[model samples]
Target chain A: MAYWLQQILNALQLSSIYALIALGYTMVYGIINLINFAHGDVFMVGSFCCFMAAAFLGLSFLPALLLSMIGSAFLGVAIERLAYKPLRQAPRVSAIITALGVGIFIENFTLSLAPYPKVIPPLLKNITWALGGVTFSSLQLIIILLSIGLMFFLDYIVYRTPVGMAMRAISWDKTYVPLMGVPVDFIISITFALGAGLAGAAGTMYGLAYPVIDPYMGIMVGWKAFIAAVVGGIGNIRGAVIGSFILGTVEIMVVAFFPSTYRDFVAFTLLLLLIIIRPYGILGKPRTQKV
Target chain B: MNMHRDILLEVRDLQVSYGHIKAVKGVSFTVRRGEIVTLIGANGAGKSSILKAISGLIPYTGHILFNNQDLQKIPAHKIVDLGISQVPEGRGIFGNLTVQENLRLAAWQRGDKQEIATDYDRVYTTFPQLKERCHQLGETLSGGEQQMLAVGRALMSRAKLVLLDEPSMGLSPLLVREIFKVIAEINLNGATILLVEQNANMALRLASRAYVLETGSVIMSGGGKLLSDPRVRAAYLGA
Candidate 1:
């Protein structure tokens, strides 16, 4: 039972990071039907932002997180406006190719700047607590609480607020929203900013937990978070959170029981099985095309 | 009172084409302030296209002047902010949003916080059924209720000129009468309306002036008495 509890805490820590990044993917996809394949790299840029804030500027946890979020949000908006907006009316394949290209460009650009992996200086003092033989760190608690807080805040922004209403309306039907005088383009940009900001927060937390950061780090993590977004249902907010937790649990358990080498294989197998089982995803509804 | 009424919207040699297919071909018309003017036509006669052009949704060659401002310079959302609201064809309600959300979204561009609150009450009073189902998702509402929500949304935008496209589409006759009554009420309360409809009998009865379109151009333009004209009666009124 103690061993299981420790594993659950590990899962929560990993899942929180996954949830933040997956939300960015799902949100951008929801507002505009683009996958925004470059999202993972945005997460990579976020960690570098955090690295600069913590290692060089000597900022603490909250400031570093905000700086990272602010930086990535701007990057996300720029990516959408420069790369994605022009192709809004283009063929789906063209937009998708552009997205993949943007991801590659972001990765290569970062690679050229930072050739070696850099370790993030500890932003939070190291503290550990053991409860009933289940050991946990203060960083883990912060990660869990902060992620849940941000998710709730995002939920409020999307569901309760007037801006959120416009976002939901835009997501539902792009046509005729402008007639209501809701600036569709502005709302879409806001969506990108919100999503990227969440991913930035995730990057900062992940960097703190892992300590080592590199340009190529976001690739595998990005793919995994995307899988979480898909498994949760690509457009649904609640589904993304649920999907992340499930992915985190599966990955942690696989490593906890079997060899660490089995982690990616098992995690990917789950995604394949999930697709075959739930094609529209766990919470996704199979939409009928209106004639 | 001045004999010459103020023109709220004017279209001059307006042309709309979707790639090679010309939708609205050189249609020119004027809507005076505080009057309901309707465009009646067959299925492909380009009624909706004209509305689309005026709302800045589509690219148009000709000039549209709303309140003496050139419409070509404005974007679609900006057009709405400038006080023209289009209650679109198919009653484009967001199915995921609730009735209240659907209504609230219309008032989004405006900063008149106090007036918006009063307007919500007015809309609720105008359509009590909407007030009753304020929290219900739009898809749950019946066709008639959805139409009501659509019109209510247009009203929420505080538009000076309300362009209604096929407002009576897909509703029962009784419901159509109720919705038309609301439109009439809305116009009487101080809104200039440009309406497009296939249901000519109801539209003609409500319109202060009506234009008949066959292919794209207006074949006849006159007042309510045009309902009795042999051409309008034969083509539209089903007489």
Candidate 2:
């Protein structure tokens, strides 16, 4: 019972990070229908930014996290405007290729700056609590609570606010939205900024937990988050969060029961099975093809 | 001179193209204040393209003046701020949004909260059925309800000129009559209208002055009397 509770806690921690990154994927895909393959690299950049702000600039934990988020938001907007905006009218395949190319560029650009993986100096007081044979760390508590708060904030923005209404409206019929007096381009940029900012926050938390940062770290985490988004329903925000938790639980349980080597194999198999059964993912509704 | 001042919209030698296929070739026309002006034509006659260009949906060369302001200089979203709203082809309502949500979104550029609230009430008053289904998703609404929502959304913008494209398409005859009645009533309430329609009989009946487009050019322009022209009757009115 204790071991199961421990695994559940680990699953929640991992799922929070995945949920944050998955939101970036889902929001971009919802509006423009592009997968935004470069998103994982943006997460990596956020980690690196947080590391630098904390270690080199002598900033505290909260300030460094904010800086990382701001930096990532800028990078996200820049990537969209420079790489994706011009291809807005181009074929879908072209945009996909461009997103891949941008991802590669970001990965390499960060590598050139820091050739080796850097360890983040611990900023938070390392305090572990033991209660009835179950261990809890402050880092774990902070990450889970912060992630839940962010998700709720995002839900409020997407469902309750006017800008959120405009975003949802654009995803439905982009061409007609402008005629209703919405600045569609500006709204798209804002979406990217919001997604990247969340990814940045996740990066800071991930760095604090693991304490190691590298240029390519975002790649694997990014892909898993993408899977979560797809499983949840690529465009549904609530679905992304639910999918991430499911993925995290599966991964944690697989590692706990079997050889750690088989973890990815079992997780990917589950994703494939889900896809075969429900191609549009759990919460996704099939869309009619428009002429 | 009095007539010239009354011209609310004037298009001069406007042209639009898509990959070397000139969709609208030097089409010129005028919409006067307090009149329902229409551009009538068959399929592939560039009627929709003209409306799109006027609303800045597509790139075009030549001059379009709306309320004496050059439309060529304005972007599509800003065109709505200038009080020109287009219903667009096929009643472009957001399927995922609710009726009330759709109406509120159309007023995105307006700042007068009181006026906007009144407009919402006015839309519900004009189409009481819309009020009944205010919370229902747009796609679930029937064809006639969708058309009404589209027009009702246009009205929410508080536009001086509303551009409607094929408002009668896919609707039953009874519903079409109902929509036309609302259109005429909208005109009576002091909004100038520019209607684009393939249904010439209905288009001519609703419009005070009309322009006939053929092969991307305005082939003829006149008052409602054009409905009597044998060529128009035979070509458009099904002689």
Candidate 3:
């Protein structure tokens, strides 16, 4: 029973991280209609940024986290301006290819800087609480709380703010939004920045929980989070969170009960089945074009 | 009024093509201040193409001058900042955003938040349905309400000129009448309007001057009353 409780706790921690990163993918896709393939590498960069700030600059954990978020946001804005903006008028396939190329570039760049995985020094690794025979670390608590907080903040910004409205408008019809005097590019850039910032925070928390960092770390986790986004219904924040938890719990439970090697296949099979059943995912509404 | 003498928008020999097919060819017209200038045409008559070109959505070869400034050199967003707002065809409101958010996004380029707030109140007063569904997502609004939100959004920009593309499309007959009434009211309140419509009768009724387009070219041009002439009635109005 304790082992089962531990697995649940682990699943929750993993889900929180996936939920945070998946929000970025979902939000960007919602607004721009482009799957930011490089989003995963942004997570990798965020972890590395945190590593550099903490290990090299000798900054505290909090400051390092902030620095990582800022650095990732800057990178997000630059990537959007340099790589994605030019492809705005191009076909969707071209943009998708460009996103893949960007992902490769970021991964290669990080590998050149730090070729091998490094263990993140354990600062908050000590167990902070025990509930129902399950131990919870401070890192786990922080990850869950921060993820929830960021998700709520993002929901507020997207639903309650003017910029959020512009983002939604552009998502529906790009040409009309700009004619209303809203600078569409600026709003799009800001959306990229916000999504990247959330991913960075997720990265920081992920490093703290697992205490491992590598250039390729973002690929697998990024793909899983993206899967979570699709599972929950891409472009819906609530869906992303719900999807993350479902994916995380399912993966953990499968690993516990079945062969660990089958986990990846199971997760992907679920994604494929869900897509076939409902292409819009769980939370996405079907959009009908006017004649 | 006499303010129609002040030309606000001038398009000279504008040509737009989609690869091998030309959508708008050598179309030219002028919209005067405080007058409703209507462009009437069939589905393939290039009325929308002209509006798209004027707003810089589609690349075109032509001279579009607003207040004597060349519009061809500027981007679409800058065109909005230059005080021209378009309520696109099918009432292109952001389906996921609320009525208030839709209005707020329209005034994004403006810095006076206070005045923008006042404008919000003004829009709500003009479209009470929008006020009642202020918190509801745009997609949930009825077709007529969406059209009102689209116009309300354009008004929030505080534009000197408003371009309406098929505002009465996909609406009930009663709703169509209400939309036309709002368009005239908006024009009377000191905003130049360029209305594009397939409904020649309604367009002519609301506009001071009218242009008839056919297959990417202007077929006729005259006072709005002339659109009801025997020849025009037979050709376009199906008399």
Could you tell me which 10 consecutive residues in candidate 3 chain A have the lowest summed lDDT? A118-127
Question: How would you encode candidate 2's per-residue C-alpha lDDT over A176-278 as one tens digit per residue?
Answer: 8999999999999999999999999999999999988898899999999999999999988899998899999999999999999998899989998998899
Error of 1 at A57 (Å): 1.4
Task: Write the residue-wise lDDT of candidate 2 on B119-167 in tens digits.
Answer: 9999999899999999999989988899999999999998999999999
- Taking the tens digit of each residue's C-alpha lDDT, what string does model 1 give over A6-48? 9999999999999999999899888888898999999999999
Which ranking of candidates, highest DockQ first?
1, 2, 3
Candidates sorted by TM-score, best first: 1, 2, 3
lDDT tens readout by residue for model 3, A1-291: 998989998898888899989999998898888999999999988888888887778787788889989999999999999999999989999999999999999999888878889776654536678877888888777788878888889888887777777777787878677687777889999999999998998888888777789888999999999999998889887898888998999888889889999988887888789889988889987879854
Give the TM-score comparing model 1 with the true structure, all chains together: 0.98
lDDT for model 2: 0.92
lDDT of all predictions: 0.93, 0.92, 0.87
True contacts kept of each: 0.92, 0.83, 0.85
* Alpha-carbon lDDT of model 3: 0.87
Comparing candidate 2 with candidate 3, which one achieves the higher DockQ?
2
Candidate 1: interface RMSD in Å? 1.0
> What is the lDDT, from 0 to 100, of the residue B122 in candidate 2?
97
